[model samples]
Target: MNPIDPQHRNDWLLRAEPVEGVERIEAFFQAKAYAMHRHDTYAIGRTLAGVQSFNYRRSTTHSLPGQTMVLHPDEPHDGHAGTGEGFRYRMIYVQPALFQEVLGGRALPFIEGGVTGDPRLWAATDALLQQISQGLDPFEQGDALAELAHALAAVAGTAPARSTGDFASVRRAREYLDAQCHQAVSLESLELAVGRDRWSLSRDFRVFYGTSPYRYLTQRRLDAARAMMLRGVALAQVAASAGFTDQSHMTRHFTKTFGIAPARWLRILNGARATEILRNTAA
Candidate 1:
């Protein structure tokens, strides 16, 4: 099959032909950018120099030096230079199915800001950030690809074993979890919803989504609690609104996720506390 050259490189200076079975990019991109278009694979990249600006999820995010950008599959977004110097970066494409092999029935991992500064990802992706023309031997190439998938899941807070082609199960599982996050969702119920057996589904879910079904559900609740808390909702109401058993449950999940309880997270988030790195957006 002929490789597609539908890349919107006019926004930048360099564009390389798509490698068969691999969609890779390398560029010292100057100038500006075109409209956003979604890709079918995991669009993970790193900004080597300058600033990469992108309009993603309705916000203008900047990828300064030493930041990694992870554009989830089919997420509509646009890109441009974030500073006067323009931007230089490289990206790799990964199919969710491959990730599913690791996470059977789980939602796709979403790292907010579409940018990351994780040491693991930074170390794993160093080579790919070079000019896309730097060729890799077959084994090394395989390692890089595997490392990327693992790195992504790791930063997203998962490390499932065996991920290779589990997209459908994971998607189904994700939809189910997202819908029933506030309710009691059992593994048996999820199996019925996604039409996959329980154990494989659980394993796959953890790998691709970077968390177990329980964890994802908890994260959703925590997300809601954060939003409600920001709006000055009562603590009890925030707990109920987030589907937590009570303020204590919400506090437990909040503490585990943010490394502090709800009150502390709020303190840091609101700048009332001096500790830096409030939220680990790498998740």
Candidate 2:
């Protein structure tokens, strides 16, 4: 299959490609590339050229070449080119579940500023962040994930002891949220199911899972909506089936969560697909 080139008129090209089943993207943007949004997975990447800048953790951060940007899961952030010449980069999104598996029941590591110059981190993520196009074997992938997790923990320093958290209660709550993500879920219902009070459960969930239950549910629905939308589902039907109240409701949340409205997101994907088709035909 031929790779897609971004639209000629647009000042950016979004490469819709994945490496070893993990969503990996290569892109360049002349100016603002994203609006305020958050993802349910970790956005880990390196800036290749020019100045890469973003608002993270309530401050403006910049990444030049040879620096890694590690945005934690569910953290709100936005990106753009920091200079007139524009910026280019490659990024990989890894699900929190992968880190959870390796870290066991501990809280996910947080790398402050969303940008890091730690050599250890760069070394740990070397294989996974390679610029070449290649697939990773299962064994190699597992090893790299493990190394990356440990390196992250090391950089973040010890997290103090896991205090003020009930592992069992949080786990139960998370499981319930995952199961009923497609329906309306109330804090009262979550309390009853998890056998814990609402506020305590909420606190525990935030510490363990990194976000509020409601936000997590909204992201999950958005996740489902995105899948269906990419498969060519109509926006209205996609919103309804994904448990959103209506099309506008979904669009609002989609833009808030992903930085792009559903229609715009679809257009970008379609553009990439069309470019790929043309390239393959020419080849």
Q: Report the number of the highest-TM-score candidate.
A: 2
Q: What TM-score does prediction 1 earn?
A: 0.50
Clashing pairs in 2: none
Using alpha carbons, what is the TM-score of model 2?
A: 0.87
Highest lDDT: give the candidate number: 2
Query: How badly does each model clash, as a count of residue pairs?
Result: 15, 0
**Worst-scoring 10-residue span by lDDT in model 2:** 1-10
**Model 2: per-residue Cα lDDT over 85-164, one tens digit each:** 77778787876656766776677899989999999889988888765346566688778988988898889883744765
Which stretch of 10 consecutive residues in model 1 shows the poorest summed lDDT? 272-281
- Measured with C-alpha atoms, the lDDT of residue 71 in candidate 1 is 81
Candidate 2 stretches with Cα past 4 Å from truth are: 1-22, 130-140, 160-163
User: How close to the true structure is residue 50 of candidate 1, measured as C-alpha lDDT?
Assistant: 70
